[model samples]
Target: MESPTEKRPARRKDAEENRARIVAAARAVYASAGFDAPFDAIARHAGVGRATLYRNFPDRYALGAAIVEDDLCELEALAHEHGDRPDAFMKLLSAIVERHTETHALVPALLRGPGEHALQALVPRVTRLLTVPLQRARAAGLVRDDLTLADVIDVLAMLSAVLADDGSGRARDRRMARALELLIHGLVPRAPVGSPIGPNSPRM
Candidate 1:
């Protein structure tokens, strides 16, 4: 069952801190275990009462969504730190891949829950953070001239597909790293060779 969200007032300072702690704890537990890690485990890790944990998050899906929201905030800060560098987009993309390595368990479970919409809603915000970096990259010929933000989004989606097949281990880490390297290589600026992709290009 969902928690009642009607007519709620602002949380107190301690309540806000508790909420943050819960989310951070949930993230760590998820990394060590998976999204199915018990709510009590998260509550204990957060050093909050079960009631406080439930008050802040109704379920694992809510925790997963909250984690994503927190991650996006971190990404916003990271992109700002990169600050118009031509390689900012690549750095941001690499950071995202690393995050997914730790958080892949959330994707399949969140997709099964109502929090999928919450994840979808953040796409626009993510795009906004990515826009400046992508623009800088294209301007500096760091990415292909024809690359669009949508294409980059698609690349991220493809990366998410890799999450489905991974087991949480050193192998998973290496696999994700290699996947990201391959994706970035494809995305890097290419020399114009008279439409080498079309029918006029050499076979094989």
Candidate 2:
């Protein structure tokens, strides 16, 4: 009748470090090889044994959840960091786009898989975190009058459509940069040209 936590011993520092490494490696592997990548592959990438990986994560869904949890914590920090700023919304959106470009929209895709209810729970938390920055953007006229939280969520959904890297790193980066720039211009009152984004831009 004992729970898993009750049965488990205190985690050693090295065990904790290995778990962190596995999760980080899982994220990287998923970005490059898709989420369904083999556990052995993940273990190899982490430089840990398959047994070590399994000890930490029971399955891919668990790994997905861990990645989502990490992302949520990061997002919460970003929202707090941009407190009361008018362009907080834009900055947050840009940061998200950059992350998606790197991770290939894993967070969005994670919502519909196994343990989805727990992942779906993220929606409200994400919404609540974004509410204040969105209000600031609206109040300061940094974004358009019609911009709504729903629109913001929709934008994330759109960005999440990208679930895997196509191995065309340069082309993929250009395409995503174009998409982010377009999304920003659509949300903002004015769109700038030659400000450094999209294809032909040296810096991302």
Candidate 3:
């Protein structure tokens, strides 16, 4: 009989490959069709059987979480590596915004589903990734000191609307790029004025 230890490696390899395949297919399908894309469709797209997809990701949220976790990991690594650069925050934010454009609408909805716990756990990690570079940018005077992590997240959430699957990809990209530039500009510290005319402050 073959040794169990020898059998284990092959099994593990196949499992890892299947997981990668599922994630890739899920990314593409979710990008075009949103998170409501059928699980069976994703399994077929990955060229894996339904049982394999289930074995890897038990539900839609599980599948979505996998894609998100992978993206966050990459973003965190990029932020850590470029934390000291003056433009690091902008660079990282730009990359994240661009990537999110692909699946912006779907992510929020997926996280609100029954299996959201998996994604909820990842929120803090994504926050951590953004924090270091944001703080660094503030210290370097590239971003306003008043800016907070929540503000950054809120901006990203709002920007997601710009990338809604309307018109052509080129049109969407052009609009999104311009919107991102405007958002980045907002982060720059401005000379304070005595008047309280800012957004919600009311005119008096």
Candidate 4:
């Protein structure tokens, strides 16, 4: 009974909602099975036919792009939330490691190249959030003076690779924490060992 113009908008809204649902279902499937997840399974989960799924996503790369966009948005929120703290660099690094461990599938796929442009677009915003805290940490002799923003990005990528290996999560996290501690220690200027100040203190 409605006019075609009014009905067109309603239909478009419905299509958008369906596409969102399909993307969500695809994300869940990928998280469980990575890139090997089948289109049929995703279609079943989305409650759509294979044809409908293809209509929405077109191919694996399209689905991957949608998921990566969601992930980058989440990462951006986290970066904003913790990027200004005195220990922002450490917190930011830890958060990245945790995500690498938990969200194993999405990271590598995004790192492959499809999401690089999106990440590049986000870099200025992310760098603005990180720069002052990182500079302060360097000034405090708490982070490496020679470290560039790109070095921090490389460290994150390496940590993600480490997490992707076939190790237990608990062991991997413990090792990553130790490695980060060592990296931090290496960055700082060490003072000579002073005399013990308390009974509980180790003998110098």
Highest lDDT against the true fold, candidate: 1
Q: Candidates' TM-scores?
A: 0.84, 0.78, 0.84, 0.64
lDDT of 3 by residue, 43-84 (tens): 999999999999889988888878888888888888878857
Q: Mark the regions of model 3 whose C-alpha exceeds 4 Å error after superposition.
A: 164-168, 191-204
Better of 1 and 4 by TM-score: 1
Q: Find the 10 residues in a row with the least total lDDT in model 4.
A: 195-204
Across residues 17-127, which tens digit of lDDT does each residue of candidate 1 receive? 999999989989998987778899999999999999999998888889999998889999999898878889888888888887788878778888898998989989998
Write the residue-wise lDDT of candidate 2 on 1-204 in tens digits.
878786565457678889889989998889788787889999998999988888888888888888777777887898888787787888887876776677665655666677587688777887887888888888898887778999987887675554353454787888777777777777875435757666864421
lDDT of 4 by residue, 1-204 (tens): 788987998889978887888888887787677776898889998888888889888777677767656655666677678655656666666665665565666656755856656555656766765677678677766666787777777776666666676465578768767766666554444544794546685321
Q: Model 4 compared with the native: what TM-score?
A: 0.64
**Per-structure clash totals for the candidates:** 0, 0, 0, 0
lDDT of 2: 0.77
Superposed Cα RMSD, model 3? 6.1
On lDDT, the stronger of 1 and 4 is: 1
| Total backbone collisions, model 1 | 0
Q: What C-alpha lDDT values do all the predictions have?
A: 0.85, 0.77, 0.81, 0.69
Candidate 1 at residue 3, lDDT? 50
